[model samples]
Target: MNFTHPSIRAQIVSILTAWGMPKHLTDITAEIMVETDLMGVDSHGISMLMAYEEMLKLGQLRIAGEPRVVRDFAATALVDGADGLGHPAAAMGMRVAIEKARQFGIGAVGVVNSHHFGAAGYYARMASSAGLIGLVTSSTRGILMVPTRAAEPVLGTNPIAFAAPAGPGHKPVVLDMATTTVAGNKVKVYHLNDKTLPEGWVQDEGGRPVTDSRVAMDYVFKKKEGGITPVGGPEHLGGHKGYGLALMAHILGGTMVGASFSPIRNRTQKPDDPNNIGHFMMAIDPRAYRDMEEYTTDLDAVIDVLHGAAPADPAKPVLLPGEPEEMMREKRLAHGIPMPQSLIDHVRAIAGRAGVAYELKET
Candidate 1:
């Protein structure tokens, strides 16, 4: 089924407002979700409504709360998310960092007490839109991945993203990826899409590989056992690098931000207690380093050369880091966004539970 972006966003806003989320926050959340869907990141799109709804019901997520600044500095700061949805806090942090970067060469913001914040690239793109380099990363609460040489899941699928503004006629260079071989939520997307999971993407609780998407979803979300593998499958293939990256994200987003780790904190069982996830955002101003025009012109040359390179397959053109997503966004904007019937059903279920109107059309 294909749905108009405006229609989806409107329904989301209505549902969120009815569920007690402030109007401004709901608008932000809806924009992020719709933008994510337009970029073809189905895992972070409307499909996540169910998870957010569940988090709200459990009282782990809230709205209309102000983020408390824990540390204030010129180029660096930390903010407590006030146990709310991660979108608003992360977005605000990026804005603050951009403000600082306008004067300073770089700025960084750390956020704690946040919940899942959809796609990290969204925040990075925010900085890129402001003509600055951007970095966004987040750490989750529970053990969600099997580390190298480990028999059990002991790390979250910590994610990292970076975006840099490009010169005229070029799209920003945006890269977003999970430390794990694949993001856990992607398994849910695959299941709903009726697609098969590839090998080495997931493992059983006891460290065995599993290729079925449905089974992987159960292991990760149901807390049954083993979960995602590191960026590399096993020790020989560079799984250690992925494991190290996960820890690096945990250190910045989890440790430095004062968020609770799955292995360290047990405050999640009760309703109203926060999951205490954390996020990190950094922005860099190109003009602070050199002349902005010169830097951008050089970047455009680099993109030109990249595009001129010979393709391994003539039918498929070589693409830059963010080109595919840009193409997807363009395509989606013209033709309506595609939604799996299963996802539409799930979104309707969320609306039903919230007692809000579902104003969507499927064809």
Candidate 2:
């Protein structure tokens, strides 16, 4: 199925409104979700709506509360999400970071008591749009990563995102990645689409890699015995680097914000326990280091050399960090966003349940 981006965003906003989220928050969240899909990130886009809504139903996400700043300083602050959706909290945090950087040249915000904030790059892009460098990371209550050689799971996917401006006449450079072979939620996406699992993505209880997506998904999300491997593959494949990055994300995103580590959270525990996820967002003004013209020219030159470099295959050109997504956005906007029939069905089911009209038109 295919649908225009605007149509998808509107439907999402309507359903979220029906679900009791404020219009302002839902509007922001809807744009982020649509932008994620526009970038061809099926694993993190509208495919996630039902799961987030479930968080609200289960009381893990506050349905009626708004995010509020709990503490403030010169260029750093703490934002209490009031146990609400992470989108609004994270967006607010980035906005504040941008504001602070305008004054102090650097700013950081920690958002606590929040739920999933879709697409970390969105917040980073916010800073880039303001002509500043940005960095963002988040903690998760769910755990699915296996250490270098350990069979047990201890860390969450824990993404890291950074973005920098190229000044005028060029796009920003943004990089966002999970510190695992794949994000934990992505296993669910593959499972829903009945796709085959890529090798080196998941591991069994004894640290043996699992190649069956369904089986691997169950092991990681339900059984909780087996898990996904860290960013690199096993220890031989530089998995330790991924393990180290995940822990660093936990420290910056969770520990610094007073959220518990995955091991202590015990996400599977009874209700009334919140995921208590946290996030860190930072903005740095490049003008503080050098003149905008000097910085922009250097950055553009570097980008040109990289793009001009030879590629292994002529059909595939060397791309910058955000080039692929930017290309995808252009293509998707010209045509329409594509989705598996199963995903279309899933989203429609959610809309039906929420009593909101499904505005997508199937091809």
Candidate 3:
């Protein structure tokens, strides 16, 4: 099915409001979800409505809770999300960071006890919009990532994002990605479509390769006997790079925010358990080092050079990290977001349970 951005966001807001979310929160959550779709991040978009609804039903997500200041320093702060949705909590944290950066040239915030934030890029882009360099990282419950030389799942598919201002007519230098080869959300999408996963994404219970989505998830979440591998397939292929990145995210995100780390924080053991996911955000004022315009111009020049680089395969061209996503977002926004029938049904079911009205756009 196809749905316009505004229409989809309105439906999400109304349903969340009916589920007892505050007006402000409903707005922010809806905006975040819609923006995920806008940026071609189907995994974190409206497809997550069912997960949010289930969390609310289990009382794992609080509607009226507000973040509390756990600690504060001159240009840094630690926030406890109080078991609130991550969108609002992260937004609040970034707002504080932005304000501090404006005043002191740099600011950082750490958050714990938060639910899944839609997309890391969304938060970093928020900082870029304010003309400041942005950095974001997050740690979550064990999902589909596997540790090197180990069969069982031990790490979350931790992700990091960074964004900075750019020259005129160019989008910000935004890069967002998971340390793992793929995220659990992408696995969920494959499962919904009844498709097998590509090799290297997951392994069977005994550390053998597997392609069945259902079996892969069972190994990762249920049996806990096997899991998704790091970006590099095995020990020799730079898999350690992805491992190092995941560990860095844990330290910066989980440890810094006083949340559980690695095995201790796996939420799959207790699906309804309140998530103590942690996040880190930093904002830097562009004027701190050099002229803002010159910096942006240099950034644009570098991007242009990278774009013109020769490709190993003539059929494919060299591309910058954020360029393809920028083009996809523009196309999807104009054409309408494509959603599967099952996801549409999921949203309708939620609306019915919440006593909210909804209408789907024709495909």
As a TM-score, model 2 comes out at 0.96
Q: Per-residue error at 189 for model 1, in Å?
A: 0.6
* Model 3 Cα shift for residue 227 (angstroms): 1.3
Top-lDDT candidate index: 2
Mark the regions of model 2 whose C-alpha exceeds 4 Å error after superposition. 267-269
RMSD of each: 1.6, 1.5, 2.1
lDDT of 1 by residue, 1-363 (tens): 789889989888888888888887888888998999999998988888888888787877776566767787989989888888888888888988898898788989999989888899999999999999999888986577787788887889899999999888788999988889888889899899888888888888677777787777888784687788889776656688888888999899889988888766764366667788999999999998899999999998988899899999999998988778889999988888898889889988888888987888643
Quote the positional error of residue 256 for candidate 2 in Å: 0.3
- Pairs of residues clashing in candidate 3: none
**Ten-residue segment with the worst summed lDDT in candidate 3?**
262-271
lDDT of 1 at 108: 96
The Cα local distance difference test for each model comes to 0.86, 0.86, 0.82
- For every model shown, the clashing-pair count is 1, 0, 0
Evaluation by lDDT, superior candidate among 1 and 2 = 2
Tell me how far the alpha carbon of residue 112 in candidate 1 is from the true structure, in angstroms, after superposition: 1.2
TM-score of each: 0.96, 0.96, 0.93
What local lDDT score does residue 363 receive in model 2, on the 0 to 100 scale?
Answer: 32
TM-score: model 3 vs. ground truth: 0.93
